[model samples]
Target chain A: MDIAQTSPAADYPATARTTPTRHLERAHYDRATVHAILDADFVCHMGFVADGLPVVLPTLYARVGERLYIHGSTGSRPLRSATDGLDVCLTVTLLDELVLARSAVHHSVNYRSVVVHGRATRVTDEAELTLALDALVDHAVPGRAADCRPADAKERAKTAVLRLDLAEVSAKVRAQGVGDEPEDMDLAHWAGLIPLDRVIGTPVPDPAVPEGTALPGYLRHLG
Target chain B: MDIAQTSPAADYPATARTTPTRHLERAHYDRATVHAILDADFVCHMGFVADGLPVVLPTLYARVGERLYIHGSTGSRPLRSATDGLDVCLTVTLLDELVLARSAVHHSVNYRSVVVHGRATRVTDEAELTLALDALVDHAVPGRAADCRPADAKERAKTAVLRLDLAEVSAKVRAQGVGDEPEDMDLAHWAGLIPLDRVIGTPVPDPAVPEGTALPGYLRHLG
Candidate 1:
């Protein structure tokens, strides 16, 4: 529940901007926390300034090593900004529970989030791009990269992969029960935590799949 | 599965920024689609342009009428930027399914997301602030605003609510089975969709709560 614990050896150095302005106690710069929050999810909200205004878009991303790879088309606006090395902020959030407090002002939601502030550059190296693209598909369903048909040369030419290093990264988390002032402890309002979990239902196969083909082990484990 | 169904009568006017450049078929501007996507989720990723760079933060939000309100501390950096009317982009995303395609390039996630771009101003009107604050709490749980203790004068003074009109908004969705090229359909890969759902679990009551709370009627309804 506490992400504030110190881990000097493996923690990412916190800069003035990444140190957090409010709730300083909830920020964690440890590498493990940052990677865990990023690896557990497949989608992310990428923020980049365009034309002196901020733009946010939800897209598919995967964390590989110390850099995060985000996928998009070559003509997409967000990805195009990174062609010249754009100053971007990529964020991933996982909501654990909803905290209900005795007072309205104290009401909060329990969540774990990692924010990366860096220059996102369009990946051009052939080897790195191949690895990043595989990580993206495996992020959604592990081990399926080898089973599926790899992108051909024509398809790969149109895809754009942006890489942002995990240099200025910080994880913020809020967990545990509600917090209410001692004076309001006796209030008659109901107070507690509503836990939420994401569950995967049965998979429906496409009609075109050949008969007698067994489901992959990775997906079987997902069930 | 189609969000592009046109309803020009109720659609928001799309400007140069809002009109999508890629995947033109999946973009939707109808007010009902935008409101539905916003109402079904409580957490959002807010993008703000600070110091000529983009910053993304995860926070709680609520939609009322034609505007969206976000609550934050008065000293928070993101909220402070809005004191003089800042340009912001707020996004809410709902993941529906994971599409497994025959080819790696075609792998995609089915999602419903709303993006709002406009000027965000700090709420100074007392009446509107009160309503926004209530909506913030109720967004977590219906009928929660009246049940909990309202914020006192001191608490209200420290809280800041930023209001952003539902203008320049658009909803983009990808909801369906896997989309793979006809040539790759006969590949030996398993292709389908893994449906995802958000299920609320049993509420965990705080230890300090009254022993005989009997769980409020609304909470019983949650179960």
Candidate 2:
């Protein structure tokens, strides 16, 4: 395995903030659990306080070892506010299935989610910034980073990158089928899991693309 | 139409927090945009400050008219803290497609997201709580509320509901295909969109479910 790949699943010590306030059984503190959930999804909802009011924004992010990197225009409010090293909460959730129970009280979704709470520090070093950008590209379309030209001086200058060390992070997962009460077992209603998944459809070519350009090798297996 | 249903979209007045610092072209303040995105997604990431640190948790929610209702165990920290009428940020995002660009800088995801900032008020009135609970059930599976027995007084006593008026809200959408820069348009790489969608698969009946019970009408239409 490449060193750049997430290190083998290890354990992340649980802190007071990492522990779940309820459903403690569903909480996980393993490094592998957190990394697996984060790697499967690119979009994360990042929460931060601005003017004493909470603000959450959806943005793309990539993970490299103990750090998660998020990028955006330097002028973006969330990114700008994050550079000041303010406390932030980043969450990535993958909805696996919708559990439809015989009773309304038991309806729940099968999902895997990781939440990280930490202060986001700006990634200012030029070399690390380049690698973070590459990671972001590869995270979206694996192996496509090397195929395309890297961001030049101007493009790199326009982008802002923030890194949050995955310290106070926890993963919560629910993978079981419908979990209804024993009393509802005899109900004449259908109770089960409606597995939900996101699949990549056929690649649509750009209108101006060259006549013979074919879909890249990495994208052919996306779906 | 049931008055409980979200009313026809109108407009949400923009405030300082609702305004986007960048990508102004993608920011939408119209009520229609906000409601459409909110109605499509079931889980929302709610952010609130806990001990001066931002905490974001994924929770089930439903929309009724101008308010969003989130339900959870009263013992949960986030839910318990929210009842104090503290400010919160709630966000829902739907990932539509993957835009594979010719260059790394332009790679993006086509998505629609709504961000709401407000102080969440605890819902205590019994009549309104029933409506909110019904809305939550229907939000997960349309027509589900009538199919299953209503929550008993004991269940309702165990759950806590918080309502946030959709006052300061904004929707940001990116729906186009690959948007590579002009100079890189002619790059010899394939550039296009790989559409992504979440589809419900065949429902698996619970192991204890009766052998011949047919799937419910609501589950049949989900896929």
Lowest-sum lDDT 10-residue window in model 2 chain A:
A1-10
Residue pairs clashing, model 2: none
DockQ for model 1 equals 0.81
Predicted structure 2: clash tally: 0
In model 1, what lDDT does residue A113 have? Answer: 95
- Tens-place lDDT digits, model 2, residues A1-223: 1224444565777899888887788999888788889999899999888777778888999998888999999888877766668689999999998887878788899999999988898888888898899999888778888888788898898899998888788999998988787887787777788888887687788888876776678877752
Q: Work out the TM-score per prediction.
A: 0.95, 0.95
- Assess candidate 2 and give its TM-score to the true structure: 0.95
Candidate 2 segments exceeding 4 Å error: A1-9, B1-9
Residue B177's lDDT in candidate 2: 73
**CAPRI quality of model 2:** medium
Best by DockQ: 1
Candidate 1 lDDT over B27-77, as tens digits, reads 899887888899999999999988888999998899887878998999888
